[model samples]
Target: MTRLGYQIPNFTYPGIAADQLFDTVVAQAREADASGFDTVLVMDHFYQLPILGTPDEPMIEAYTLLSALAQHTSKVRLSALVTGNTYRNPTLLAKTVTALDIVSGGRGQLGIGAGWYELEHDSLGYEFGTFTDRFEKLEEALQIILGMLDGKRPSLDGRRYKVSDALNVPAPLSKIPVMIGGGGEKKTLRMVAQYADESNLICAVEDIGRKLDALAAHCEALGRDRSEITVSLQTSACVAPTHDEAVADFEAYLQRNPAAEVRRAGTVVGDPDEVAARFADLLATGVDGVTVNAPANGHVPGRVGLLGQTLAPLIG
Candidate 1:
């Protein structure tokens, strides 16, 4: 059965205060938990994009926010949508997740990805390596994290990282699920097939089939069942009383952020029934989960609730 999840609005709202944004998110998470959403995911970004707002605008650190979230909500699964490999040492990152899992009673998932967004890295004085170099680092970091989580002192000497006798204390109470974010067929998909417990793709109806096909090939190469790896998609969402209202709301949002491209190629933005139907289509593609990115201020809470309350049942 496919599960439906929601991404918390962690970025600063245009006119909202940082503390207010955090409170809004915590309250929304409580509502989402009560509304039956399966997961509450947050993105790991150091700065707000110019299109979204400004770099200097308020942005919260991901793991710190997650620690707060662990205390605020009890039932929902929590995770950073994908933590960048460039941001923290792998051993340290693994230890952080282990602690979070323990504090959250084993409801944490670790989502890791190769770092992108060079502007943030440059502004923060982090190394912005070539694409290949970044991917190598990510792969090495994944190895370190997995090894540490397995309660073994792992040693690695790789092109990008060298680790010897790493220990992560207080192993996760449960086997923490590792989620890899990206659709890079060559390396990312192959790594997901080999290592990740779940994989996330940007939602694009026309391309979803193709992405899954590539993932299937990767699974075949690894001698694993494609079904063993949960499939998830990220989408921008808008829903209203009618299809027309939904489209208008989405267009209004686009108008405000003209430079921001609508990257959710496959999205459901309509009345509850129409949204439910679209989710059903995703399930047909072997998607086991959908993580909807809803707007701030409860603009579409009804729609978000409908997804978990109505759509998930239909798809499941």
Candidate 2:
């Protein structure tokens, strides 16, 4: 079964210098590792996401940072929220993840999805095509990646990608888990049924049960057991000593990212008991794990620990 996870999406924190950016990230990752958070993730993008901060905000390349993080933390699994397939060739991405698994002592995960964030693609020289084109590319990419991870040389002649006896050496130390992040019922969920060890559902609180149902239907139609694919939720959360304090942290977060709008139904902010209550309800929706983002004060010394203390027991 999958376990609790944490995502560090934003690099720009108030009063933190650019040179000190990764130090802050390392702090959060280490804190989570010590606090029983089973996994830690970063976003795979060249630029800071608009939903998080301006493009010019301090953003490090995903795999490089995760590699550096592997040395600093001991137990938590490392990955991107979802690596954008368009950013790197499937073979190279597989090799990179394989190396991560080796260095982290086999605590690496590969979370991927069809690339989005058009602005980054346009500015960074990656091909930004139609939605259908991206999904088709992702499908072919996954085939290559999955095959390579299985220690098999793959030969493919597909529409978006082609390989003639492609090889990945030094395969992962363990069967590195593949997590697909998205909620597209037709394409994404179908891919989850086909290739994913886990699936991340980013939707409103009320919509979780509906998404789980959709995924189950996809699994059933594909002759895949739904239990084989662990379900995870990506939630924005803020936990503090008191309810009002947590809300203030969330509000402060909004001030930092003025363009961001908090999804009241999906966003969680409260004391430990309150946060635990929300986790209980989320668990009842059939989600096996959760990856939380507390962009506001996550870099603080004990904020991530508060989450571990509050909700880790509520999950399996």
Candidate 3:
């Protein structure tokens, strides 16, 4: 299980040049590897998310970057925080993750979710369907992805996708864990109970208990042990050595991306002590772990290490 995970959601650092962007990212990954983070994630987006920056801002292709990161770091598992299902065919995604696992020496996890962000779908020429449509597609995709990972040629003739004898050669070095991300009690949590090794909820701190209850109910309905699925919350945080400094960094980031405040329900903004208090409250809600994105000052050198070490001991 990922007791602590670091998510790199924003790539537009204040002073970094475009040519130096990847090097900056590598530095953070290396720090995470050395620090206490058990997993390292990047958002799976073709364009910058609206909450972070404009679409034209830098967004690295997820798998390519993760594969590159595999060479520079060890120990921390690699994955997209939550990969969108509409980006590629299910078979292709399975192959991609398997290859990533092999390259990373069995340290890859597939964190996937039903596709959202209609803008990317529309702009990138992928189908932007309704909620039901996307979820149904994700259901079928999971079957194919899961089967392929287990070294079986899965054949599915579903409404959204159809695959016959899809083969994945050079299978993963080990069983690549599947993490399903969403908070939908009916479809999403139920699917997590049926097909996933982890359930990542993308809700506010206040909603964690309710979402987890729903997951437990789903697990019970299927006669599956709720403990079989590791629960994680996706959240935001700004941590520094001092409370005043962390608040300043948070406010400055809000200034750069004024639209970010709308997504602050689960956000923690303060020094290590203060942030640890907030995380303590979250951990009390029954989540097994957390994956936090530090958009405020994550790209700054040494920030990732500070956040990791500060929160590592508190995860238990």
Return the TM-score for each candidate structure: 0.90, 0.96, 0.97
List the RMSD of every prediction in angstroms.
Answer: 2.5, 1.4, 1.2
Model 2 clashing residue pairs (backbone):
none
**Candidate number that wins on TM-score, 1 or 3:** 3
In model 1, pairs of residues that clash are none
Instruction: Give the Å shift of residue 66 in candidate 3.
Output: 0.6
Q: Tens digits of per-residue lDDT for model 3 on 132-223?
A: 99999999999999999999999999999999999999899999989999899999999999999998888866788889888889989899
Q: lDDT tens string, model 1, 1-316?
A: 1156777643545555655777767776777677777777877888875655557756677788888888998888888888988999898899999988898998888988998989999989889899998998998998999999989899999888889999888888888888898878788889999889898886456777888889999999889999888888776566676888777766665665554444334446777778777777767776777777765224334555544565556534
Question: lDDT of model 2 at residue 177?
Answer: 95
Of the two candidates 1 and 3, the one with more favorable lDDT, higher being better, is 3
Q: After superposition, how far is residue 7 of candidate 2 from its true place, in Å?
A: 0.3
| Whole-model Cα lDDT of every candidate shown, in order | 0.76, 0.88, 0.90
Q: What range of 10 consecutive residues in model 2 has the weakest lDDT sum?
A: 258-267
Worst 10 residues of 1 by lDDT: 295-304
Better of 2 and 3 by TM-score: 3
Model 1 stretches with alpha carbons more than 4 Å out: 241-252, 261-267, 296-303
